[model samples]
Target: MSNNGSYSNDRPPSAGETELATDPASGVLFLSDYKKHEDLQQMLDSNKDSLKLEAMKRIIGMIAKGKNASDLFPPVVKNVVSKNIEVKKLVYVYLVRYAEEQQDLALLSISTFQRALKASEFFIPVLLVDPNQLIRASALRVLSSIRVPMIVPIVMLAIKDSASDMSPYVRKTAAHAIPKLYSLDPEQKDELIVVIEKLLSDKTTLVVGSAVMAFEEVCPERIDLIHKNYRKLCNLLVDVDEWGQVIIISMLTRYARTQFADPNADDDGEDSTNKPFYEDEDDIDGEHDPSKEEKIKKTYSLDPDHRLLLRNTKPLLQSRNASVVMSVAQLYHHLAPRSEVHVVAKALIRLLRSHREVQSVVLNCIASVSTKRKGMFEPFLKSFFVRTSDPTHIKLLKLEILTNLATETSISVILREFQTYISSNDKEFVAAAIQAIGRCASSIKEVTDTCLSGLVSLLSNRDHDVVAESVVVIKKLLQTQPSEHREIIIHMAKLVDFINVPQARASILWLLGEYSDRVPKIAPDVLRKMAKSFINEEDIVKLQILNLAVKLYLTNPKQTNLLCQYVFNLAKYDHNYDIRDRARFLKQFIFSENSKLSKHAKKIFLATKPAPVLESRFKGKKRWVPYHTILTPGRLAIMTCLLSLKFLLILL
Candidate 1:
């Protein structure tokens, strides 16, 4: 017989007839006899074991490739009683593939599978205790694949027996089998949980990891079962594989959250035994209050179990694996005490020495932590300074962190760093640097003069982007510090010719209109020069110019009446509806006989605008929780199928 399950002659081919023949034209094997189900059925009924085995392999390969081999299930099951191990293995492979599709027909194989599970060779159970670990694991896997509930007891006995096998490989395989049994029949979950909990204490890390994974899938809500083994699992956490570490950390995080009550609650609605002491009155004359001291001490304290978990996890911060570090950091941030959060934050910073991708993630986590716990990362402020070799995204993240950590004590150090960044050739970095400086000046009053001075000096930068960004920062600064920084008007006036970008031009025009009375001579020329290019400017610049022209006319109508009229005339016939409407409203307000409405319009736009503060993108949002998985549903299915295939291969 050929590999295609077709006999070349009337009688079966001899042992040497194992070679397959190919078509001369297509270079493909020509299975002329096995094209239909009848040919494959005939081959399965042949007396020769080789022919039956070849037929079974062809059918399985077809089924694996998504062909319909359901009609051959009866013929495939007939060979289950064959004495040849190789032939029986192939038949078992065929059964597992189509069993769920043809459940009624699969019931016929339960008796044969049970007999094979109990088969003995020279008084030794060959299938279960075979010297080859793969053969033993495979036999156990196949027995578990039969989803019929009638065979559940048989499969359970086999799994329980294999769980204690001397081979660690068999023990691991047994651990994975628990979830399969529970999934097949939810009633068996309690019994399987008992079996899984025993394997958790198994000395082998491989078995323990697999066992915890099974527990996570089968009995995740029953976390109390792990309380007895919590210390042992934490001790072995670092020694497991990277993926296993993620699972253990997630489990520990859940356990910690459950074990400890809400930290924010002074009384967790529990009995008096769990409540800590509190002080009801304020201290007088700066004297120490013993009740306040006790409350502070109790808030920072941790129970023995949580303390141990944190201690074991601290070393993982220096781990070479990025996922491990991130998981540990998230665990500390979510469940650990606030006072101990600095330890994890420092660990995240250490991860910056890794790749750029890791650096970006670490910086984001650090930024979140620092924002919540103010001044926690202040001592190590210099660690966030941008390096020249860092990528653009990473540089941006570091700059944000620097801005978040700025305060009275660290403002000077951060300002010096910003000065260096402003001189860099990267236009985006310089722009961000200038913005960061302006934010610091807005928030910290002491640094206002120094930061504004630094920004004023950057207006001379040759790069148009840098100069444009400086104009924007200075505009914001003027909104907050208009009285002290009137000197910036002279410097901004000198840069009118250098500013060509629409946004920059709009900023300078807005400044002149708001402070027109401060620099009256130079303001009109800037507006007239901007008026010449009004037809070609973008909508944003045009809108700012119109508003500035209104301001110029209202403040200094003697010298700027015609310039404002030219802008209003150009805007009145303009295509944009917003511009035309504004032109009409301003014309009515400025030249109207209704003095009451015109004064109201003047008072509204002239009011002091609020200062801009540096806020995190995640401000006022909930803290982020990292996702960890023991085994996803898709992965579980794939693992079950692969184990079934391995069982069939071992028989061959």
Candidate 2:
């Protein structure tokens, strides 16, 4: 072996190598040439630079070969961590490649790595919190992969320091790392609570927001802690100047509802159905009795069943803040798992009866919640059920609520409800109803076809954004319901011609990709409309339109040679590197024999290679307007056309 990375040992074969050690899975020899190991160990111990480098390469290769050669990393870490600067740099480069190439082996040497991590104080932070953002980010990633319980406090300290770090990227990376620590040790939930307290007080909005989100991830399992600290957590909810009250309240609610689950019920334990929390002492059946004298044994294995979090926290449902009220209702749904259907149903009704804002918030929460708790659907559907007799606000709120509940569980009911609303001739309500149905179509095929019947009328409606949102909805619906709904789609294609907004134009073209073979019957015309959008659109819109064109070509390669032409043109002339990259991806996607786009693969390589000075000048400019603006030019053109109008369009 030499410094250039090659095997160097000259020793004879060991007995382990003479006999084949077959693996059960791959049916390959478990051990290879033992002389390779002998030479590697000798070179690793050698002072000669060439042999040492050869040892480094051999160690990496041995680890790659799935041998238990990671026994050498402790010695390797001891050697590398003590080396001088140039040697240390070489060691780091090697370790990083090893970390990247054979992460599991590195992980196997956890105690060895931890010893280096704890002793060489600089390396931990260098990887996790270096002033160089990339180094800090990459180090946190490696540390997270290690998953040792002892590192929790160390990781927490780093998180606290990162909260105040100047770079948003570093802070965001730190925020992500906080959850990874919990993944390694769920018992660190209390430490996470402390981190959340500091994060909520931090000066940076991103830090505070990230901390609140991290709390939502780690704090759920500690519902008893949240129950104990309800007043304190809720007090923070009252701090008037706080901008993240919604997230804080949402976390508290999620914890109350989801995390404090009874493991007995979860695992179908026999004792789960026995009402352990509220058991009447005298009513215990003799047959079901365990040792009556047994004391309550404590272990972290089961979370304390804090049913009181749900039972005691109901008053917050009447709190003035809509977010608080909504969260309280959501919490009841989780904590009251025994009869949660009634609990959520009643709380939602109470919220609806009091305030419009509460109603809207509760409605959003109920959409997804009701889907999971579909048995509660009938009662909730009736409570917010859209009717001519109801107030317009109630009717509008009901439509939104029904739209929200249209996922896997409740889509069938939502479809049936849509027919009832569409059968009536109230055009205004009918339009709103169709939009709600659009929301449902994405989740279920039955509802998508039911809504597809109204596409012709929706396409002709005066409201363009409703039509546009409907187009987006139909695209999603077509994905699941394509074979059965092909005729309805042919009608949708005729309506596609009426949509002039470039955003809608691009969306319609993208949707056609789902039915790539049926582009002729669907919206082949949309490809041309989307392509034209690139001519005068802002660079951002042009980029999106270019993506849409590429997607269309990819979907139905039979009709769209235009994708290749679009890419070739951009690669040759687009001023933006991103635009050139889009062109490159299009070229590779169309021409590469493998044809699969590795999503995580770097896109920059395919990006237009920089033209030096021109690339640097345009580097940070806002390259493109949003696709919605391209779709509806008039709305963007208007100065005070009421952003409220846009809001209404969005809910539709």
Candidate 3:
């Protein structure tokens, strides 16, 4: 055994080295690590699993402390063959940490990990015989987390037995285990399906939510398995824990969407008066489908099962859990007849008053639905108004909803709200406000002049984004009725000197060029000013300046002839290829002697083109606005939320 007196820099100290006796800080730490490594090697080699487990933990502790435990890889990899699952778990964990660097050693553990994966004997005994239900439930929960393919039958057996267990706690844990069991060995899907069916039929509401959740995951397409359980699920929808309610409601929504006729298919496009649904108003309790008496009376248009599902879900609109409310909101959104779809709006508006994040999600749902149908959101227009505490994203979402909800009656109110947004310091948001102003103008023609007047006023706004966005809005308004808006075009032309933003500069140039006669005096001077800064201007402005110069020269070639020749010659040598190419084309077109096209430069450049068809950007944005997705139950998210609930319960 070498003494600790002299340490080798290239090699670790021998297992015989005791205390660190080196001079340098790194040598001392290495020597100290060698001694611990030697102790760990001894502990790992012990026949006692406890000692090996302790060594595995210490290695993990070292790794956690940001120390290099890669030296322990070979020793730890051997323990993957340990009979104790806990010991194997720690060993495999250590191997995963350094598997890339220790490939040969890690490969040695794969067969063992695969073989050990089939071994669940350790948890089975505790899960089966533990007197404490929590211990039994937890044992089964832990057992489910084991990724052993061979343990499926044993786990399935345990799940089947636990599904019928007297304690709801054990049954709930078993219900949760169905997904893990299916994940470990999906071939056992047939057997797991039997188990899920049994769990769904279990009388406990707590177990039912999880059972439905598992059913959705393992056999989501197997709606037939849930058909008999449909009435039961509708009855239990509100009774499940808040987390369970989200899952059950979401499942019911999917089931209803597939199972029933589209509630609005028969309706002509007339305003269906919202049959007002207040909390607990004529609410029927008990496991009742639509009664024979109601069916004979033809009291509802939706199928009996659909109506039953809607009735069962409608009251939960008031659930404190935002997710629960959203789930029900989705229920009404996809399945409710138009008359009843409006019922979910009040609840959605209430949610916008939640904290910033909640408002953001709920606002999206409202936006989507508002686009689908308008009046539902009109009443809550003020609720979507920006609050001082609202973050920039929340403010933008609110602005989108406000614009989507614009009616002739609401347009005045919404445009007034946009005025406030324009004045805010948030540049991105201020720009969106300006764009929304254009959308509002586009959506409602009655408010065209009103929105244009608002935009023209914002051209003088100190914020560059506000001024820039305002220029775009004015152009769109002018495009709406180009001839009627000659005055607005002239007004934009007058402000060209104050607007310096690239897009704003380009926008002014485009309008003046498009309607040059409207501002004949201003157009020539604007082109010369733009020409002075042509090299420094953005690509977009430069392109517009080129087009404007061509248009103006074509209008009166003799007057702009020198300006054209000079500008084209300057652009010809510019660094940008597109600009240079465009310059060459224009210069040739204007001066070509035998190039027949040059003779008709005025006919070519001054030809009147139709106004561009403005696609409602609001229409594109409306697709993302629906909050339905945020509340819709996702497969993995359900498990995560349930796991969190379990963890919280254990903490309590």
Candidate 4:
């Protein structure tokens, strides 16, 4: 070995020469030759720069393929002291990868890493302040990878100096290094907090994002740190990239909630705040009070911070980026004053104009938000109308929002639009549309007649699925408002032949049984027709037929007694235990002639079910939107692993 730059020509071939070769098919060089670990030692001792670079490349390729390159750590460590910047970068990469894996050997390379950290020409300050941002960033990265507590002070100082560097790229790298330092010595959090907060005001958006990320990781609970920067964060909320927007919005929401401990200081409780200002005609007995409406509007304006967050975030709802829209919407939903949350709700509706995949996500967010603030979105009901060009999923989601937003003012428009969907050629959309119409009917008494008329007309639809779904919805509608929709029983009976589905048949049978006294002439005929396929009918149909038979016998015993007797006998011998048991119970109950039990059964069968209503999608639930940040556990782990591997390829 020679101390000078030159070495004897007797040195062995580098590992690159002994182990790597080019594949003919892909034209990519790969490590194919399996040489002993000592071959790497011989290559590292060589004075040839080209040979060393090639050997390091080969080692990095091996490491990338997930091979154990720790055995070569000794020679790789020696190369870290090389004057060649490229070789130093490759060596640093290899050290980061194997540092934690080969901690013992990694300790031997710390001195070399420190030397590179401070390496510079006579007039150059240090590698930390190197002219090339890449070199500067690489130096900070390498220093961060050394996890020894004893070196924490040196790494901390390097990060602090790099944080103030003129390069935004270097400043971002320093922001990332703060967490690594804190993890090595958590007690240093106080020391790093100052540096992290300073980076928050960096001129570059990327640097600001990185700084916020650092603050979240080091002291997320320190609301005081965020208090001073709250307005700045809101103003910069839109400029940061998508991921940064998530962090900043989440932090702002936390700060707002903390500062305004009682969100209902002027507003009501959470549920009351979500209640819509505009009520249906029935809510006020069809009378509109001008003074009350004026009072309600006056109470709904936004507070200072809430107004600021909304002002900054409202524009983000129109962002072409889905993540930005979702984050801003979630922030508004969780933190905005109740009176102004409607603005955010409408903003989310506008996102439906984006791509289909995005439309689906936006619809889901709207659905979740609408449960809390339904009236806020009622005015935007037209926007959710299904577009013929939308994908099936989007169309279905749009239909859901439409139904959710249905009210006295919007029901007529929604019903008319649903009629068009029911006539669509797409069977699935038609079925969903028919169901939507039925749901609207069940919810709003004003639309019950019009919706049922539309549904009854769909019985003549050519699509069997459309007819079947129509019958299902009609069944639900009849259950909800039996008295109001009883006239449709005749139309439903006429469509019994067209209803081929088991569930559809079951629904019709239930309708016939419940309204037997109303449609006595046709009810028995429908039950008898269903009985012809008694052995072949589905279990659900069988159960409904059994119940209908019992009800028909009770309601119209003269016309249905013999028919009910035959069906009950067949069911009593059926293979299914449930049907058999039900048959026996009905027979015993009928023969016993207990008037009280008979009346109880009649009342139970004829009782009106609660109207079909959309349950709160997010009631008693925290409004959560999935957003990725550097502080997340999975992201942090992946970053650590990738940083290690990337350093190997770039430096070693």
Per-residue CA lDDT of model 1 for 482-508, tens digit only, reads 766667887887787778888888888
Q: State the C-alpha lDDT per candidate.
A: 0.75, 0.54, 0.74, 0.73
Q: On residues 288-371, what C-alpha lDDT tens digit does candidate 4 reach at each position? A: 465755664466533444545667778877777677778877777777656656766656766776777778888877876666
Model 2 poorest 10 in a row by lDDT: 610-619
Evaluated with TM-score, which candidate comes out highest?
A: 3
Kindly indicate the candidate among 2 and 4 with the higher TM-score.
4
TM-score of candidate 2 relative to the true fold: 0.39
Can you write out model 2's per-residue Cα lDDT over 497-523, one digit (the tens) per residue? 577555665555554544545545344
Q: Count the backbone clashes (under 3 Å) in each candidate.
A: 0, 8, 5, 8
**C-alpha root-mean-square deviation, each candidate:** 14.8, 26.4, 13.4, 14.4
Which portions of model 2 miss their true places by more than 4 Å?
1-264, 268-332, 340-344, 357-368, 386-400, 404-435, 442-444, 487-497, 520-534, 537-581, 584-652
Clash-forming residue pairs, model 2: 1-8, 9-39, 127-139, 503-631, 540-624, 580-608, 581-607, 581-608
Which pairs clash inside model 3?
364-625, 364-626, 364-627, 365-626, 365-627
Backbone collision tally, model 2: 8
**Which whole-number lDDT from 0 to 100 does residue 272 have in model 3?**
36
Among these predicted structures, which one has the highest lDDT? 1
In terms of TM-score, which candidate is stronger, 3 or 4? 3
